[model samples]
Target chain A: MEEGCSCIYSRMASRFSIGLLMILAIVLLMVRVLYVIYRCGKPLPKGVSQSFTTLIVLGSGGHTAEMLSLLSVLRKDRFTPRFYIAAATDNMSLQKARSFEDSVAEKPAVKEASQFMQIYRSREVGQSYVTSVWTTIVAIVHALWLMIRIRPQVILCNGPGTCIPLCVIAFVFKVLGIRWSSIFYVESVARVKKLSLSGLLLYKLRIADQFFVQWPQLHKKYPRAHYVGCLMIEF
Target chain B: MEDRENAKRVVFVTVGTTSFDALVKAVVSEDVKDELQKRGFTHLLIQMGRGIFFPTKCDGADGSLVVDYFTFSSSIADYIRSASLVISHAGSGSIFETLKLGKPLIVVVNEDLMDNHQCELAEALEERKHLYYTRPHTLYQTLKKMELESLVRYTPGDGTPVARIIDRFLGFPDD
Candidate 1:
């Protein structure tokens, strides 16, 4: 009876220890996230002005085309933004994006050092939680490598799919005192209506520093959002 | 006799995506086929997209509506040019492409059973009067009475709105 009592006590102690460890880990993670948010929410550090070298554009399909067209128009002047196109595997936009980058490289002003990262398509498996987590991990590693190599001050995101992972990496960098801003391009008013409740909640997290929307109606939706008249590359 | 025959109205059916069930229904329905035959519409050309299954015979109009499934080899611009009236799915890509060609388009919304987004897109287009929208149930009736030239013109420009939105976010000049 004493041996059984001791065994029960030991089992309870082990369980307590595991629970305690999990609680400690969660607390540490929360602290890190809070720290990141605090750091990124602030202004850039003084006397550390660097020219925007690389601009990572994240999206697939027609959204990428829209970004490339905007970049082409903007490339005419002083700002020469290098392209980092992130896409999903077997995406039609990714194939076209390669050709777009090749064509842009031919231009005198735009120096091409394009990197393509493929994320797993969510549609195939009805939202892949495991693949999503894996993609996020890979994105963080890739972002760190690119930050060290390319040294971009600005990250332009066209949509949520690719941007969400990239933005998390940006937040990590922000915590480390690396100066960067995330610019989000809003496609349509219809998109705002289509966002899932979880997505809206995530948006409130302010992963993006600035949001530009085509429709004036979105200005009401995102009070802090800027309404740009429109960006177009005239053919 | 040849001159008179050449002047017959050409009805063009363009399927932007194979997922469009309304287009399939419109083409295969016996009632619609009979009505089209009675109307003396000449040279019915059907542009089939990927994943769309075509019947061997469209009720004795086998040769009338030629199905070009996933044929990106030839430019579809030529077909849009020759079409007197263009019938298509209500995808933004198709709507813009057809409008750019200055053709009269009758857009059929792929039902909620097909895709919910199609209905939303069709509703938006109908509100703008850019194209005539046909629900799955009323597609045949809508097509029969569709007046191409009467459509309100909605010009779809380049991605200026999207660009402007991005520029604003980037803190660039709105202009």
Candidate 2:
């Protein structure tokens, strides 16, 4: 009789675990659907009729150069009260940004960035999967902090893997009525043929408010993304 | 394409700060050596830069001429100035430097790199008649047909390309 009771208890425990797992899966799916519905095939346009607060994500190396070029293009009064964000290890970007700002300081129409701060890198494309998961979680928390702290009206980033977590957090902010931020993702000019990993993820998942491709070929392929000409004319 | 290799031409094979064993190996291979020798390149100065492999026996190392290599040197600008033909990894710094000097450049893009941006840059320049480019495996094949004098000088653009499109994107008055 005791053996029969033990077997029944084990079965009940297994059923409870399975039910909990099902609920978790269902909840995850619902959130994903909500996010998708919020993001995909829908253009979140924030008309820049007047200057608004801007957050620009700067990736290391080429991305820094490209963003600098973009920033160099825009008038100071247009993207006022600018905030620059980069990965903590990207000292090169910081130096370049500082020098660039200094170079443009002499101009009357330049509105310098309010602040440029570094955040921890989420995960590199080639890093191990396990470490990537932990790093991504930490990145999300960091991004959440920035999103909450800055509450930027518009966020601009080129195709960088580091931008993903921050943009995802922005989506969470939007969905939960925490904040409203427009994400403008520009695919780098170097991507002649296809959307980069970041661009691909943002495109398929419907994360970016405006997705701009430098090449018309890429625009032809994606159709949704705009062809904005050569961001880097050298390339 | 003279057979007599007395060395007016310096072939600078620079890996540009990073270790590129594939590029080093390809440039040092028998086919590449023979091509360089045939092209009258006297000295092959390799800025190997942390690359493990070295040329087993340099082209004409037995007194006629020699191949020189260094781990790292700050004299990259000096090398680009004198090089008859520059073969390099598709690093932007190296590319721009070589372009600025108006030297014939053959860039070999590192296929194992995390990004293909460098490759795109090389292709664009190649399209614009600015430089010749190759993958590591086909280095010899590409080098065989590369024209030294025909490579165009690079022109840096003026400051106004970024404004109009950006203005449009920002929903600002596109003046």
Candidate 3:
């Protein structure tokens, strides 16, 4: 009778241990997510300097146009060594960036601005969640390698799925005391009511050094998001 | 207008980067095929995205409907610029570019799209007489009355606001 009782007790103890482990795993995940969400401090301000190397992402089609409009208006000497990041299959973005460079090249003045731009293509993500996860993992690895090589002082991107891995990497770098690469997240003009997936992730994780919105309504919706009007290059 | 008349007799149909099966199906329908031929569109180039349905090569035996299609193209700006007429899914990327290029554009709003703000945009632009707006289901009817001359010249922005933000961010105050 004692032997059967002990056997039953051992079975119950094993089940209890499994339940405890599940709870422990869930709790750890929650805490880690919350930490990532709330631990980040506000962005550090930096004066504009010629030595500042800026990295900006052009997310395929519309984002490419926005990038062009934004880039065209800047003073040529402000951001030295500007690097443009785009997705691998986004040849349109690359073409637009190249053509923008060409436009500067054709100009008699500020010809040096054309030479400051560099383009890099990251892995293209698909719509499927499963495939996107795999591509994102690969992209994270690639972005880590690029961050190591580029060592950019500041990184800026409008909403795109491709921005998440790099922003996360920037967050990791900031956390590790390895480098202080400032990240700026700009929500696209098209998103009036809700944040895009990239915006949501950055907002929830509190990863961006600065967050900008195109509309005032969005600014009211998210107190953390800054509103500085819009940047649409529409007809 | 004279330039459009002299441009190549090609109709460019782009679904942007998203698989829009409804738009593709409507384009290849027998009615649309016949109408395009009657309108002197010598070629129909469709960027179908990942859409499964594609019309077979427009063999002369099947009523002079020359069809060419691809799943995706990274750079279709030239296709948008060079064509006599542009048919597109109402993605802002396509809408703005088409408007900028002053192409005769017909935009179909995918009603099922989650952020189908495209529908509202198309309606606004249609009211402004910039482009032809049609829902996917009603595309055939819209095409029946389609007139390229009806498309209005879109007013271009000064591109000042975009420059301001970047300059402000980079420490250059607006001039």
Candidate 4:
């Protein structure tokens, strides 16, 4: 009788430990979810109004100049624009981009260098598809961190490479009821394959309240596209 | 030609990221080199694209020509300004920059003959009498017949398709 009772006790103990571990995992997951919500919930700090805050430009190389030129024109009002150039590893274009950003900005600018995005040059291989997907994840994490810190009202994307991931973060913010912030897509769909990619990409972009395109050609490709005249240099 | 009257006539050969075999064939051909040498060209500058495996050097049979390679240079615009003739890849950036400098240009397209966006650009400019173009197979024949005067009258206006796209980005009329 005692042996049977001890056997019952051992079984009960095993079940209890298993149950305790399961409860612990659930609590941990709940805490993580709450923490994410809390972090996402926090508003931009006092005096860091999205309207007057600096815009974070997220590309390197010649494309950086294009964005800088756009920012130069937009700096006429009571706002200060800053830049964060996402450069490739050991690229001359990265150096040129940094120098250009330094020369243009009136105030001290913010710059971040990472090998998070790069253009695939090979035609025989389809490495870009995989690289692009991975880049999207990294960009989202980086953008989330930036959003928590800078809290800019708008994030302007000039390249499809980094813009895709940043758009995902913007979507998350939209879901959390952060309606004041906006995301912008610069380039238009030219090829059919690119159009299909844009269709999948549009899910992330639905969070963008305003969508701008340079050409009327894109209207046939993307029905929801709004024609914003090209961003030209005033000088 | 008059734009760079002070500078000697320099033929810029740029076989962009097309095929190295095509470029080698174009350069090795006797007719094209002989014609260029006869023109009293002062120098030959080659912007060999990515696929070129060897260093650029003089190749004329007469051994009187000088060839220079430009890989990556901060002074590309200055070099373009100094050149009497600008030969470039059919890539939009090169095409736009050459036109922006108001220099005589010769574009070589990379299309697989069937799908030819570059060929289209070349034909449109050729119709406008703005530039010269040659297929890989007929490069020598085309070069021998190209009239320098026909190319001199063509100058591309301000900005390119990309610049126009930017203009549209800024909300300017496409026209």
Best by lDDT: 2
Error of 2 at A120 (Å): 1.8
Cα lDDT of all candidates, in order?
0.57, 0.76, 0.72, 0.52
Q: Write the per-residue lDDT of candidate 1 for residues A53-119, one digit (tens) a residue.
A: 4465545333554566566654433234555656545455666666666776766445445555565
> What is the Cα-based lDDT of residue B5 in candidate 2?
44
Using TM-score as the measure, the top candidate is 2
Q: Where is the poorest 10-residue window by lDDT in model 1 chain A?
A: A189-198
* Ranking 1 against 3 by lDDT, winner: 3
Q: Candidate 2 chain A — worst ten consecutive residues by lDDT sum?
A: A40-49
Compose the digit string of candidate 4's lDDT tens values, residues B36-143.
767667567766655454544774345555566655555565777777777666654455456667777777666454434445556656766777876667666767
> Model 3, A94-116: lDDT tens per residue?
66777787665545564444322
lDDT of 2 by residue, B16-86 (tens): 76788998888878788888878877878888887788766455536444577888875687999998889
Per-residue lDDT tens digits for candidate 4, residues A1-235, read 9999999999999999999999999897767545544443233343344234334444433345445445554432223344343533325545654565565545653333111223322121244676767765565566566556555555566553545544565556555556344454554212211232433364233644345454455556666555554443322
- Provide a comma-separated list of chain B TM-scores, one per candidate: 0.70, 0.82, 0.85, 0.71
Window of ten residues with lowest summed lDDT in model 2 chain B = B157-166
**In candidate 1, what are the lDDT values of residues B101-151, reduced to their tens digit?**
777777776664532544555566666777788865787898678665678
How many residue pairs clash (N, CA or C atoms closer than 3 angstroms) in each of the candidate models, in the order given?
A: 3, 0, 0, 12
Better by DockQ, candidate 3 or 2 = 3
DockQ of every predicted complex: 0.15, 0.18, 0.18, 0.07
Off by over 4 Å in 1: A1-51, A54-60, A76-81, A101-117, A121-151, A189-192, A196-202, A215-219, A227-234, B1-18, B33-41, B57-84, B112-115, B157-175
Give the alpha carbon lDDT tens digit for every residue of B122-144 in model 3.
66678779889998878778888
Q: TM-score of chain A for each candidate?
A: 0.62, 0.75, 0.70, 0.53
Identify the superior model by TM-score, candidate 1 or candidate 4: 1
Candidate 2 TM-score, C-alpha based: 0.71
